[model samples]
Target: MDLTSNRQSWAVVGGGILGMTLALRLREQGKEVTLIEAARDIGGLASAWKIGNSVWDRYYHVTLMSDLHVRNILNDLELEDDMRWVETKTGFYTKGRLLSMSNSIEFLRFPPLNLVEKVRLGATIFYASKLKDWKKLESIGVCEWLTKLSGRSVFEKIWKPLLRAKLGENYQHASAAFIWSIIARMYAARRSGLKKEMFGYLPGGYRRFLQAFEKRLVDAGVTIQKGTCVQHVKRTGSVVKMDTADGFEREFDHIVFTTPAPAVSKACPGLQPREHGLLNGIRYQGIICPSLLLKKPLAGYYVTNITDDVPFTAVIDMTALIKPEEVNGNYLVYLPKYVDATDEAAFSRSDDDLKAEFWPALKRIHPHLTDDDLITFQVARARNVLALSTLNYSESLPPVHTSIPGVHVVNSAMICNGTLNVNETIQLAENAAVDFLKLDSRVAADVAGSRCAQAV
Candidate 1:
């Protein structure tokens, strides 16, 4: 699908799905695209690695029926037809007991809240789903908004604990838009016939999709530079120059930085002080996710939300949604702990030390479990997994078009109205690609006009 008319070179300095999308989009616009990644392969957070005899996603991921952007990407990769969809249930660990909260009946029967509290909680979700002015939510604190809608008891017994799990103490700084975005997405799924709560996944997970996507990029004549760390990026004259840590330098007509805000700030020192400040203003939440391959399933529910004190945030039983045969008849579970990226204590604790804290909680949740059921245990850590949706987040975000002539910054921090997910990421890339091409055209026209004026 080469649309080459007047080819211009582009350098995308990140190989995640967002970067891959940008490269592919640029190439379709008749641009020579080069994707450079610091890691050995693409799929930054979505990458998979060996876990004993099987390979699966390092972090837990699921495709909701409402995630049209993700489905579109799968369609482009020709993997949409092979997707497997399954209905799964949800569980809640509260008040020293494990309970089912999947359907309206279970939710009404939930022991943590009385009848009135249950009604308020349900009403809160329904109201949030109908909200259209999410920007107004950014001005209000999450705690205040939830407390007002769900009442004090429901906020304390239910909402507070869940917020603490996902955002830690940083929930204090979050806006109402944060929770609204989440409810909107879930309701959107319900609108798509997921009232049964259906989730989908590819057979081989993202690894197979990434392999196919990489091959497609290659077929489209896009250059892939893997395992290359970009040290510095600057614009000189009409083009942007990038210096790699491996003693390699390359120049392109324009550069699009798809890295995190901090990394982009470090790589491009030529940006304005305001741009640097905006980049530094963004905060991120990190995750320490441990994948446990067990001989038997812990709970049949797909996701178990915990309100009780636990080392990890939630329990994700992958086998509940995916077939056990996918992982050689072994059940895969993810115990994820979300912490502030600056939390040195949580990040510094070793694998063995974490296991010491986590194993006890696992047994506490499932009292009948024993050590022999565990086949393998692996942990995955990331420093800046998702940007925090702080109050007025979008207002403080660095724009895609920077002060530098041929440089642009596009990252997850720019995701204002949506939660951090692959779907939102792909949509961001699509919008950024359009903006980039328009900026490129304007810059090129300006350069040509200047040359004509000089000749006259």
Candidate 2:
């Protein structure tokens, strides 16, 4: 095979937004791109599925006004102009009651904290937003940092429970940067030219956006292999070989593995020991988010943060952002619980078992919601969702370029700074593509030059 062609063949081994975007970018660079996904579709975390009669995202995702990368892609797909932006309210479930903490008045009256505690809590958020030194925050544990800023009362009464809800017992291992990133994004939402926290979404959720995106990719001359799993990867001379589970092999000039770190480690056995250790060292927080198709809305707030004991961390009322008419006039709610990725028992629990525990807790929060009000229930579990921002997380992250020539690993584990959302995911892919492609091109040029010199 000639290694001097201007057009290089690239394989993106993951159909998530990361891989899709990478393939599109590479194709735009005049490279022949092939996207392979193990799932039936290519959206990965942003993928949509049918729940009852409605087709919606497998996990709950909302677009923030600050999400520039996401908006850019939507613009390319001609869906940005059609985005529906809404000012949604926030709720806090605490002290056995649901309270509206969306505004100043509601927040002042919140019963979970007294005036002093509320002031301290507010100060903590304000302080965190103004702090720009995120790397320094990584040195301190989340508990110590929050308690220092908010005091013991505010930390115990509010922050601790919220931390446990999101991070589970893993909160103890997290750094103050974890909380800072969350606060920074929430603050950015209000600062994103809207001057208020405005969440936007397409009319048909991700289904419409993805269909358009898929068409755009296909039109751009990118090959998509859906339901095809890459079992192993090896480097052979100037080309990278990918072996599928079906015993199919394909060689590409370069290949990028956008799958999870563990998956990458298993697929490519030739990685250096240090690189393998770094990849395996990264910890991820999994989510078991269940979508509830309800007859009526459960609290009008888009997001209801919980400080009380509940089976789920938060209640995301999709109907708040999306009109009820969208899903057949039925409300859609997402109850997500972030668990340790290694917790097999939690992931292995049957749907019926979860229903038994989840519904009763939800009823406790809203007694009016009963079995009759429930239209249908569906669970979406991902063992690796967001990479946990541990102490000095970025310092240990494996580089996108692996030890093997022309084989790179780029996944959610590389997203160390921001929350794992569509925007951050897109940004990571765009940035990684630039760096990796430059290196890839240089390597190809070197190989071509050496071959020409040898022949001469």
- Most TM-score-accurate candidate: 1
Q: Choose the strongest candidate by lDDT.
A: 1
Candidate 1 lDDT for residue 57: 88
User: What TM-scores do the predictions have?
Assistant: 0.97, 0.95
Candidate 1 residues 115-234, lDDT tens each? 999999999999999999999999899999999999999999999999999999999999999999999987776633325687899999889889999999999889999999999999
Candidate 2 segments exceeding 4 Å error: 1-5, 191-196, 444-456
Residues 119-140, model 2: lDDT tens digits: 9998899899899988898888
In candidate 1 the C-alpha lDDT for residue 361 amounts to 88
Model 1, TM vs. native: 0.97
True-structure lDDT of candidate 1: 0.89
Residue pairs with clashing backbones, model 1: none
Candidate 1 lDDT score at position 357: 81
Relative to the unseen true structure, what is the Cα RMSD of model 2? 2.6
